[model samples]
Target: MTARVGVVTFPGSLDDRDAARAVRIAGAEPVALWHDDADLKGVDAVVLPGGFSYGDYLRCGAIARFAPIMTELVPAAASGNLPVLGICNGFQILCESHLLPGALTRNRSLHFINRDQVLRIEAAGTAWTNRYTPGQEILVVLKSGEGNYVADPATLDELEATGRIVARYAGAAPNGSQRDIAGVANEHGNVVGLMPHPEHAVEALTGPSTDGLGFFTSLLAHLAEGSPLAGAPTG
Candidate 1:
């Protein structure tokens, strides 16, 4: 039974297909989920690929957070019974959904920054990051205008103390995220989100090195541990 990973496609999503392809390349079955449909289709995990969901209205993921599908996803994720990986716009959704801490704000540069970004894995205990060893560095494409991650100083301290800071920009803070954070996970380690796109970097023949493959592969190892996510099926 191959692991089934669901990729949700919002109206403005641009990389849903790429995300599904990356899941397939990582040896899992990719399941297509719709933004309005609340059915998860028995997937072992879910991925919210990057894009300008709802035309980035009001804020990036603010409006998309209220999508009908998120109605189920929210509770499922909050119960810590589901594994979710939110990339770029999806990251914004996670934050807006309150599944993750902090908010992705406008970059200090105030321009859409597109570049191959290097990131350091700060923690690897999350379901989506188990394949990466702490301190490991990998490059992936980062493109967004409102990509800076911010939170109150106290909240930031709590995250650090709890080891919730999963990854950070390796060198220059490309988007000026606080402390150069590129990704983070919930306390239970089931929910994870990142601004850089690992799916885009998964195929060497297509773009960069295959360093991003680990993100999807990591999910396989994550759910193989017999998590309690309902309807989950895995190889």
Candidate 2:
């Protein structure tokens, strides 16, 4: 059966369509989910695409965190029955929603940075990253105003010790993210949030590289195994 991946569209979401198209290209059915809809329509997974939701008011994802759809998403994700990937502003929402730890602050330079960035995979255990080998390097697009990730040192230590730092900038940090982190996955690995826009790079013709397609394909493989959507690391 083809996996059904739901791409959410919040008020000012700019990449929902791109996310859906990437899902299709990955051989999954794209399901357009609305912010107001509580039901996920039995999707196998979900993607929170990047955008300036609520005009980035109060904070990038502050307002979108309370959207009705998140009511179900929160618990569903916690249950480990569904996989969730948040990109860019979507990453902001995930952090705000407490689905992941830490916060995305303004760039250290206080400017919106846009470019093709290289990322090193720190953990290949997550459902969305199994296609990569740990420590693998891949290129993806990174574009956002508030991209710096911050958390207490203790939390940062815990995340690193537990292999939760899923990805990190390959060379010089672009936005002052703690530890040069580019993305992270929750303990269960069902929820992942990344500062870069992977969906944007899934198409080679228009994007810098097709490396992002691995994320979508990895999820499908995980679901097909009838396992918990997350693939927590094992020492």
Candidate 3:
């Protein structure tokens, strides 16, 4: 059977359908998972697409973190049994859920920036990034107001030391994210949070380039390999 990837839809989500399309383009079945639904439907992987969930109340993704679906997603992802990819607002949700370290704060400009951004793949070993080559640059869409990622100094150092920093801004970071960090992965590498919208870049007709397809394809490759954990750096 082909791999099944779940794309979650929380209230106010805007890119869930785009993510599902990207999954289908990557040769996987896209399963629609609602925020209030507690069951995951046994999907091999999951994608949290971008949008202002719960109207970005309190903070981006703060309310969505408490959604019933997360009740099942958090533990499964924590145990390294489920692979989760959070994009843009989805990235904020992951941080709010504590599935990944650091918080995405307002951009230093305090303005919503939307543009095609270049990102350098910093950790190609991660489950969502394994199809990429380390240091390779890919262009994807980035549209957000609160996209600055911040963490305690120690946590930042730990993430860097352990090869968990998944991607970095290729040029000067538009949001002023610390250390130009754009994405990161959990210890086991089954979970990743990216501030860019890869789903929006999977098709040439719509996106800047087809670079974003690798993120979804990587997960399919991992599922096929049947690895309990992925993303270990290779020499």
**Which residue pairs overlap in candidate 3's backbone?**
125-231
The numbered model that scores best in lDDT is 3
Output the worst ten-in-a-row residue range by lDDT, candidate 2. Answer: 226-235
What are the root-mean-square deviations of the candidates from the true structure over C-alphas?
3.8, 1.2, 1.1
Residues 198-234, candidate 3: write the lDDT tens digits. Answer: 9989999999999999999999898888866643733
Model 2: per-residue Cα lDDT over 15-113, one tens digit each: 999999889998999999999999999988999999998899999899999999999998988877779999999999999999999999999999989
lDDT of each: 0.89, 0.90, 0.93
- Candidate ordering by lDDT (highest first): 3, 2, 1
Error of 1 at 92 (Å): 0.3
Would you list the rank order by TM-score, best first? 3, 2, 1
Clashes of each: 1, 0, 1
TM-score of 3: 0.98
The residue-level lDDT of candidate 1 at 84 comes to 95
- How do the residues 1-235 of candidate 1 rate in per-residue lDDT, one tens digit apiece? 8999999999999999999999999999999999999899888889999999999999999999999999889998888888999999999999999999999999999999988888898877778877888889998889889999999999899788878888899987888899999998887778889999999999989867788899999899877876543211110
